[model samples]
Target: MSCTSSSMDIVPDDTFNDFAPLSKRRRVSDCSRSCEDSSCAPLKKFWFPDGDIVLEIQTRLLKVHRRRLQCSVIFSDMLHIPQPFETDQIDGCPSVALVGDALADWEVALAWIYHHDEFLNQVVTFDILSGALRISTKYEIPGLRRWAIEELSSRWPVDVVSMRLNALPHAAEAITLAQECNVPEILPAAFYALSVQKFHASADGGRSHLVLSPNDLRRLIAGREALQDALLRIAVDPLTEPGCANNAACAHCAPRRAEYWRARLAPDPKSPWSTWLVRELDWMLRDDAFAGTLCPACFHGHMSTIKWRLGRLRGAMPGFFLL
Candidate 1:
């Protein structure tokens, strides 16, 4: 069931809790015929804050998630009845991968503008997993972000899922994407733990490789009093501090067994809390690893702390720090 509305509300998944184990990996057999076409052209790769995402997106042909055996067989029969193409053609056609671009690309496409319509025609496949988990990494992509929103309304698995704060791959990217898309539900898993962690801050800490800036540390203190009361919160904690690996998946990372046990109580069918996950956040926080995405509330808190910190530094050195 694909959305026809320009601003389609995402597929709704009221039946499942966010904390519940995500649905299983989609099989190659489950894909649609258009998605499966070998001739589909991949989306062009674009530059973002982090590494080359979707570097090979358009190269791969897509298939529908194979829940229907009959459909698959029929599609295969149709595909085998080959049709001719221009002999000079070296490139294939476009696929849905092209749809994922700057957020503006989505507005153009969804609005059915001619250029975007051409862009959509080029797309022959749509990744059912929606790459929300992928978005949860260092930075989010708008096309992918919108896709995830729609996917959220339907039942989909957390493909390649992980919440171990420490050593969590693409954690920062995922969080950033979530925040950009205005998907607040996932915010708790993304940033709260870091809000309560220790920190060493580089100015505008988030701009560079640093995750939880010094500003972030102060914000954490406000939410969890012990962080500041413990004395030099940022100075003491290794995980939350820069130059320290926040990934807890490594043998060196401290385990959070108690948090793991506590997480089981969540995933209730009757409450919004079911969509909230903390075992991973707790473990990450306990490990002192700060996930990258800062929710609106958290972002505001960090801004406040930075303003305060800068003000304090200015008072100490009239020439060096300015308000």
Candidate 2:
């Protein structure tokens, strides 16, 4: 993620525990509430203390500048309504009751609107970025929406290995957020990362909310099986040939190198291929001592073949995740 001017710490994992289905939160009536109410008082302390608009999002209240809300077409239209009693009022300022979104998400969105330079400068985490994307899209904030999408797309990996390395920790949540926010660009890599981790229909152990959709789960399972088979076939191909050196180097080290490749590409099904294998192969290719184990002709031949095969595998990977 790129930072713009000011930044905040990404929300921690424990913080996400505060997020529950909207139905579970206490619903605040959209009727008028006195600003003197304890629940409504603290929300008045946001930037721009004298802003004309207050948004009661879930249990939290936010004071926002009317000019800032006008930057969004949706908000602009919403704020233009002249019917005063039709909306909630606090301290004589119009209060828009925004329901069905988490307080954390609203905070991020409002922060971007009021303190954009600072928000942009901070290093955003997956959770914060996804929240911004959701709110921006909902409010028709085109600029912020585009920034969120670009940040996500830039961080999303193009290959399975890179995806596994960078996205595996949060693959499930990322996939769900991408789908909800209409960000298809992150799906391929996110899905592939999930596939590599081995799709499990019951993986979330009945926590369906934390799992992918049934259709996506099926696609991941099929793609993973196909990729594993292709990788095994490429890795286990015969390395010895009639014209190759028949000396001790060929007889001993060649088999060991071939075995190494086999173990990496086709590990026990319980211990499937992972980023470690990719890193190991990369190191072997670069280390002079490892490369010296084989004769010059055989070494170059095997390296070239492996490189070509891996390239093809990577090229074909994206298609496997297509739904």
lDDT per residue as tens, model 2, 2-116: 1100111122233223221112222247544566672644464473567786666666667778888787766565445444244445655665555566778777887888788
Question: Model-by-model lDDT, in order?
Answer: 0.30, 0.61
Error of 1 at 280 (Å): 16
Give me the candidate number with maximum TM-score.
2
RMSD of each: 21.2, 9.7
Question: How would you encode candidate 1's per-residue C-alpha lDDT over 1-323 as one tens digit per residue?
Answer: 12111111223344322221112212243232332343544332322222211111234422221121112222123223333232111123211232233333333222222234564445322232224323322132345345555443222122212334331232333345444555544433334333322233222223223444454334333433432332243223322323222222333222332233234323345431222222322233433222234444443333343334323322322111110
Q: List clash counts for every candidate, in order.
A: 41, 6
**In model 1, which runs have C-alpha deviations exceeding 4 angstroms?**
1-57, 63-97, 101-130, 133-171, 195-226, 229-323
Stretches of candidate 2 exceeding 4 Å from the true structure: 1-33, 37-48, 80-88, 198-209, 238-256, 266-288
The C-alpha TM-scores of every prediction are: 0.25, 0.72
Model 2 score (lDDT): 0.61
